[model samples]
Each structure stands twice: as structure tokens, then as C-alpha cells.
Target: MELRVENLTVARGGVPVLEGLEFTLSPGQVLILRGPNGSGKTTLLRTLAGLQPPLTGSVSADPEQITYGAHADGLKATLSVEENLRFWASVHGLADIAPAVDGFNLRGLLERPSANLSAGQKRRLGLARLLVTGRPIWLLDEPTVSLDVASVTLFADAVRAHVAGGGSALIATHIDLGLKADTLDVGPYKADAHRPRTDGMRDAYADFDEAFS
Candidate 1:
């Protein structure tokens, strides 16, 4: 499957962050999004993942086929490492947790509660969840944050394996993850700050639409 974006305009709080953007992601390919801070990398990823609506244009991909990993590790602090994986596996209708465990080197911390793990361990767990989802497309935002040199290699291996298995990824990060991928710089697409401020009005209207729909 391929994901195509056509004349896409994405906004953050009603301010256009990327306008007239276009790209296509084919199976087994990776696209790296590069930009300075506040250049809308995260917003673009969120929009592609369908967490938010695009202000204009279209993102042509099945939402169910996409797995998004945000900057924050979405874990239950009280749950054991294995339990957390199990929960997500069940949610995704997956039967095997072995792959995820082995992929992230979590075999040693299976019984440890998420609250007690170090930042790198937690990040590994978060990335492992993507494997269990069985989704073909990965939308990762700064996935290498807080990872040590060795851990970064581990993550890079996982990404390589995923692509080898016919999966694709769209990653937003400042550092190189050692993957062969195309780069997209979002700097030129940033919206002008001098434009009118309609974010509040747009948000209020969105709330009204959600309430009535």
C-alpha cells in the first residue's frame, strides 16, 4: 500500500504550519522529516496519523493501517513491562509478544513495573508497541529522544527490520537514525506569524462541531 498526500495544508491551533505540502510513501520506504524546533514537524506527523484534521487537501491512507508513536511514552505506570505489552497486543488482536520483547531487548525487564524503568527502557517499550500493532505505516515523532548510543543502534535495527518486512515509516527527528530514507525539510512551509489569529475562533467552532455531531 502507498500513502499519498496532495496539496496538503496542515494547521496548528488554526494557524497554518505547512501549506501546499505533498509526498508519497510506498511500502518498505522511510521518509525522514527534518526541521528546526517549532517548524511543525510534530504537527505534520499528527495530521498524517489522523489525530487531527488537515486544514486543507487530503492524506490518503487508511487510519487503521497507521501506527503513531508520539514523543511521550504511552504506558501505564503501574503495569509490568510484560503486562503492558500484553495489553497492547490484545488491543491489536495480536497473539505473540515474543517478537516485541525480543525486538526491544525487554526480556530482562518483563516483570518490572513501567514506573521503575529508566527513560531509555521506557522508550524501548514504547517503540516495541509499534511492532505489536501490526500496522504497515509508522508515524514516529523524535523516537530517539533520551536513547543512549547503543540503544539508538537497537532502535535503528528494529526500524530496518520493519522496513525489510515491507513496512514503511515517517519519522521526525533532529538526529540521524542510520536509516536509508528520503528527507523532507519543513522550514519553507512554516506559516507567517503576522497573519490574523483565528486559532481561538477555529478551536471554539471545532468544539461546537464535536458537541453537536
Candidate 2:
């Protein structure tokens, strides 16, 4: 499956940030997103992942084909690493966790509870969940946050293997992962400050004032 974005508009905190964005991510490919802090990279990914709505435009993809991993680790603190992986695997009707565990070199930490793991370890676990999802499109935001150089390489290799197997990814990160991929800089898409921005809920009820305000 492929991801197609057409004239998309996304907002943060009720303010439009990115407007008229467009792109297509086909299988066996990667697109790296580059921008300064608060550049709407995260907002764009969130819109693509269906976490929130886009103020305008569309994202076309096969249903259930996108798996997103953001800043939060999304781990169950009391669950052992192995248990966490298994839980996500089961949710996706998958029974195998070996590839993910080995891919992230997480076997040694499998028996430890997530709360007991270090920051980098937690991030690795969170990312490993993507492998078990069996979804071809990966939407990642600063995925290497707490990882060391070695771990970052491990992640880069995992992405390579994923795309080699007909998967796709949209990654937003500052550090180069040395992957052969295309880059997208969002500077040109910033929404003009004076443009009307809303969550699409406001209406002519405006002058209706305090009644629905």
C-alpha cells in the first residue's frame, strides 16, 4: 500500500501550522522530514496517522496500514519487555516476537519490567512494537530520542530491512541515520499567520456569542 497526501493542512493547539502539504510514500521507500522545532513535523505525522484530523486535504492509504511511534514509549510499566511485545503481537493476531526482539537487540532485556528499563531501552521497546504490527507504513517522530550511537545504527538497520521487505516509512529526526532516502523540508508550507484557523467546530454561531461560545 502507499500513502498519498494531497493539499493537506494540519494544526497545532488550534492554530494552523502546515498548509498545502502534499506527498506520496510508496512501498519499499523512505521519506525523511526535516524542519526546525515547532515546524509542524509532528503535527503532520499525527494527521497522517489518524491521531487527529487535518484542517483540510486528505490522506489515502489502505485501512489499518499505518503504525505510528511518537515521543511517548506507550509501554505498560508493570509488563516485562517480553510481555509487552507479546501483547502487541497478539492484538495484531501475530504470535511471533523473535524478529522484533532480535532486531532491536532486546532479548537480554526481555524479562525486565518496562519501568525498570533505561530511557533508551524503553524507546527500543516502543519501536520494536512497530515490527510486530505487520503494518507496512511506519510513521515515526524523533524515534531515536534516548538511543546511543550503536542503538541508532540498530534502528537504521531495522528500517533498511523493513523497506527491503516492501514496507515504507516517514521519519522526522535531526540526526542522520545514513539511510539512502529522500528528504522533505517543510519550511515552505508554514501557514500564514493571518489565515483563519480552527478545529472546524466554530460556525456562523459566532455572533450567537455566549450562547454557544
Candidate 3:
């Protein structure tokens, strides 16, 4: 799958956050989007995911190619972990999602409502939705937000496995995902000329913990 964005610019409340941003994402590769607070990291991910339209430029994605996991967990608070996965799988047109559900170790929490789960558990459930979707392109925002060190490592391993299986990801995070991917900084392409200069690409994330905590 291939995702191409040309001169993409995004604006919210009449304020331009990203300008002249271009990206070409291919299968089996990962594109890491990094920037500081309010640097349009989430905006970029939203734009790419088609949740928010770009103010300028075109984003072309292959059919059924992109699946998004937003900054907030999209699971329903009223539903149990298993129900959430089953619902999402049905949405993704997957009849058998057991493999992914079991892979994420969600068995123990199967009967627990989303509201009852811990922050980390919720994040894992959201990730399990991704595996069930089986899409080639992933638009993930802060994937490790509530995960512990071990869970984070497990998530990283799952992502690596996804890439190895000929999938790709466009991750927007303030922390390091340890994915060995290319980095794209939206900070430098800011449209605000009056705003004070901030950090550069190298300063997007000092460490992965900064992105989550």
C-alpha cells in the first residue's frame, strides 16, 4: 500500500498548524512523526487518517489501506473488552478476530468493561482493534500512552512484526517507540511566523517516556 500527501496544510479555528508538508509512505516501512506539545502532531495524524480534512493539498490513500488509532481510546465505555474487540472486528469485516484478541493477552480482561480497565489495558484493547482490522497502513497516535515498560516492549514487538509482515505505520508520538523508523518533524513547517522559534527536529522527543507521561 502507498500513501501520498502533497503540500498538505492543516488549519483549525482558522489557524494554520502545518504547511507544505509532504510524505510518501510505503509498505514495510514506518514513518515517525515527532514534535513538541501543540506542534500539530495529532493534527497531522488526524489529517492523514481522514478524520480531519487538510486545509490544503491532497492526501491519497489506497482503498481500505489505512486504519487509525487515535490519541484517545475509541473503545466504548459500556462494552466489555471482548465485546469491544468483537464489535470492532465486525466493523472491519473480520469474522475471526480471535487470533489478534488472544495475541494481545486480553483474555483475562475479556469480561471487563472498558471503563473498568486500566489505562494500559485500554491502550492494549485499542491496539488489538488494529490487528483485527488487518489493514496495511496504520495511523497510530501515541500508541504507548498508558502502557508499562513490559507492555511497551510487547507493543513494539507487535509493531515490528506488523512491519515485517509487509505493513507500514505513520506514528505520531512525543516519545520513542523504538521502531527504527524515519522521522518527520512538523515543527519546522509551521505556518506561524509570529510564534517564537521552538525546538528542532532533534528535540521532538528527548525520550519515549515524554510522549506518554
Candidate number achieving the greatest lDDT relative to the actual structure: 2
State which candidate, 1 or 3, has the greater lDDT: 1
Q: Write the per-residue lDDT of candidate 3 for residues 1-213, one digit (tens) a residue.
A: 789999988755445778899889988899988888888888788778876556679998964788988878888999999899889888888888777677678888999999999989989988888888979999888888888887888778878889899999988877777787999888778887454433422233233225646
Give the least accurate 10-residue stretch of model 2, judged by summed lDDT.
201-210
Q: In candidate 1, which residue pairs clash? A: none
Per-prediction TM-score to the true structure, in the order listed: 0.93, 0.92, 0.86
Q: TM-score winner among the candidates? A: 1
Clashes of each: 0, 0, 2
Clashes in model 2: which pairs? Answer: none
Which residues of candidate 1, in runs, are more than 4 Å off? 197-205, 208-213
Candidate 1 clash total? 0
Q: List the residue pairs that clash in candidate 3.
A: 175-208, 176-208
The lDDT of each candidate is 0.89, 0.91, 0.81
- For candidate 1, the TM-score is 0.93
TM-score result, candidate 2: 0.92
Question: What is the descending TM-score order?
Answer: 1, 2, 3
Query: Model 1 Cα displacement at 141 (Å)?
Result: 0.3
